[model samples]
Target: MPAARQHLFLLCLLLPISLSYEIQLILVNNCNYSVWPGVLGSAGHATPEDGGFHLGLGEEAVFDVPSWWSGRVWGRQGCGFDGQGKGSCDSGDCGGMLQCKGAGGAPPATVVEMTFGTDRSPLHFYDVSLVDGFNLPVTMAPVGGGVGCGVAGCEVDLNVCCPSKLEVKRNGKVVGCKSACLALKADKYCCTGDYGSPKICKPTLFSHLFKSICPRAYSFAFDDSSSLNICRASRYLITFCPPAR
Candidate 1:
């Protein structure tokens, strides 16, 4: 197997078997630097890890979440905090704190969204979304999901080619690519008010560019048909800076 797959397999073998009743999620940091991962559960769902944690280079954090949980995960970069855990990140900050709690990550950050299986249905739905924009290269894939299961993410770094108007820079380096909606704030770009409907909301040039590059991720709010992935996996892997295939 390739080195990346081999690493994933080794990580899977290390998972605890006692979490049979819950779904397992492994957040791996394969980047050269450390990453702070933020988690936020949907309404009525429980947030795990108190919503945030740190993962050093090549490190991984494992969680056994409720089987019926639904949440989103994103990475925060260039962050620092005091003893009180009060600070901010260059990208994807949440309430200027180390732990995001229930707050969502700021836009221009790559996001991994998931809904695990419930008692009534064994299907689990997940996807990597760029609708908010892109700050990191991330991937979400099933560890042992059965046939037809697909990976959802943008493996390529979008900041490198981000449009000048939509680029978010820190220290003279491009760190994120803002979505058209965020950069323009127009009803047409945001698909709000009269453009809220799918019939009226169409992909802009920027969204089309995003879609062309990150085909498996949501480029716009109405991008659902092909971006969503449904499966039945007890364990899923979310990796930051996933090695290029």
Candidate 2:
């Protein structure tokens, strides 16, 4: 329950808030002691003499991300000698090894990213939370749910449907719309077919739903927030996207 760990529980602020590769590595001594990535070179990799870098409380270090590499990066505390922060050590994991436990050596960060990456989206996220439209929290097993109702079980548990068009907007500016999953849970469209025309929730139904549902609590920018979280329970849900069949 370190101070830094508590506040900065999660994030993905990207890197280039200032300039990509220009400043990739940074050190913060908000802990009892401090640590640095030392000089890892352009490979975005740090070596021994280069690793085990240390700092004092209230201290800060900054290093440029290696120019050669591209992907996710981090400044983690190694369970090194003495033990994590104070140079103490860990009996297991990185036992002082770099990249071990992913700097689990210390708690989360308090002085977090001040900016984001430009070349790409600056994000150090819980890669665990997202995977297509399927989130482990809402539905456990891979069995998709929404498609059927009052039924026993089915392969696609989660169902999805889109309107003829979706009226979209951003920041209250009315960006436009596209008929799609206006609701997050898993929309159950109208099966009321007309002369076997395959009746389902039509554009008007979904359009009305979106008008009544999304805009009030959500916006375009909130794509980061879980759509399932907004609405509690519903027989019909809408979505801009859905998992692959």
Candidate 3:
């Protein structure tokens, strides 16, 4: 082929490549437990000896959202990332940057960094849950943990089953919202039973359907079954959305 034709062919091949950008799912191995909190006991490896408060296993971080993850995400019962908390979904469990128990029935997730890669969505730091301050397993604490939180580690506070739905915001900007969008889910956050206890419901302001029932030290863990891995305090997990164009 002539030189001009060859150059044209090269441009055609590279055109698609230029439009896409690379995103990184960088893992910081925060908290410095350095013990390698693993899933199957052989999955992940811990690094540092110690640093700040160890995040433990199954604990993901929700870093400042990337510019690419602008669409909707799987929010749980209340926290809304895009202005609509769990209340928007049919299940009424949406929230901004949430940490769910399992992978919401998705395939074995491969934490990704780039926006246009083969891996699935890229989630910045996952919104982690707590079981209070007790770093040990449930068998050890029996009552569970609380928070030794400072800033990001501070026990994420939220009005659980509040009677009057308060406003929601993402860094001062409304994300998941639409006037009455904060309305409570029927048969779910009823004023009757189900999470009526102060632990589940505050009753004064409104029950905090999601706040951790932990002391000043320990954290309120979500799923007890995952305690073993969490106790390791080494192996940790992080989720993210694929970077955007």
Candidate 4:
């Protein structure tokens, strides 16, 4: 074979391995009951696992997300879906569909957001957010620890202590906790108008309570720097109904 042809063949042989780096997300359901895992990819990103799937108690689903993928994941409880995938959930329902596709979960749901690395940037960013509210406990941690990689999530079940006015009830039970912003929708609570920046939108009493309970999770808008985590890892584990700390 010609030298150039030999070189080209070798490159082709190694290309798949070189581009095989992926972010493996293991979604584990640790609750006593079954839960449906909902996934929503960011703009231009592809939702994996058909966007949603059912996970019985103690079951887990693994997804191989391409590098640079950006998306959010959450859990839905008490969902009743027909064969055609049409249904409603007690919490975190996405347009009455079993597969969320690109649809985001309803408010009062705990969310895990992740952005993987790109060629220009190698750092992966991830965080658990309670800014919308909390329906279930969640935790996100790298499979293998990397330098400066920190776990982010709310290990405690916020529903137990959810304020009466901010509680979302289903069958006379608190199914989810509502953020003051979602409960009130005021500019001050939502961090809008003049209170849009980190400098101005300081944590409120409610936000402070959430932060105290889940210090690593994002409690409100502009809760960056402290809540946002940067790491580089090949795999991450997201547990629903995470064990209490």
> Top model by TM-score, which number?
4
Candidate 1 worst ten-residue window by lDDT? 13-22
Off by over 4 Å in 3: 29-245
Candidate 1 clashes between residue pairs 3 or more apart in a chain or in different chains? none
lDDT of 4 by residue, 1-245 (tens): 99999999999999867866778999999999999999999999999987899999999999899888999999999899999999899999999999998899998999999999964576999999998999998889999798678899998999999989899999999999999999988888889998877788888999999999899998989885678889988889999988876
- TM-score for each prediction? 0.90, 0.25, 0.24, 0.93
Error of 2 at 109 (Å): 10
Candidate structures ordered by TM-score, highest first:
4, 1, 2, 3
Candidate 2 structure quality by residue, lDDT tens digits, 89-113: 2111223454332332221111111
As for TM-score, the candidate ahead, 2 or 3, is: 2
Task: Indicate the residue-level lDDT of 210 in model 3.
Answer: 29
List model 1 lDDT by residue over 120-199, tens digit each.
Answer: 57788899999899999999998976655799999999998999999999999888899999999998988899999999
Candidate 3: tens digits of C-alpha lDDT, residues 1-245: 99999999999999866754432222333222221111110113121111111233334432222223221122122122333211122111212112331212011111111111112332222222222111111111101222221111222222232123433443553222211212444323332366534356322212223223322211222222222211211112232111111
TM-score of 4: 0.93
Residue 242, model 2, lDDT: 20
Worst 10 residues of 4 by lDDT: 15-24
Give Cα distance to truth, residue 192, candidate 1, Å: 1.3
- 31: Cα error in model 1, Å: 1.0
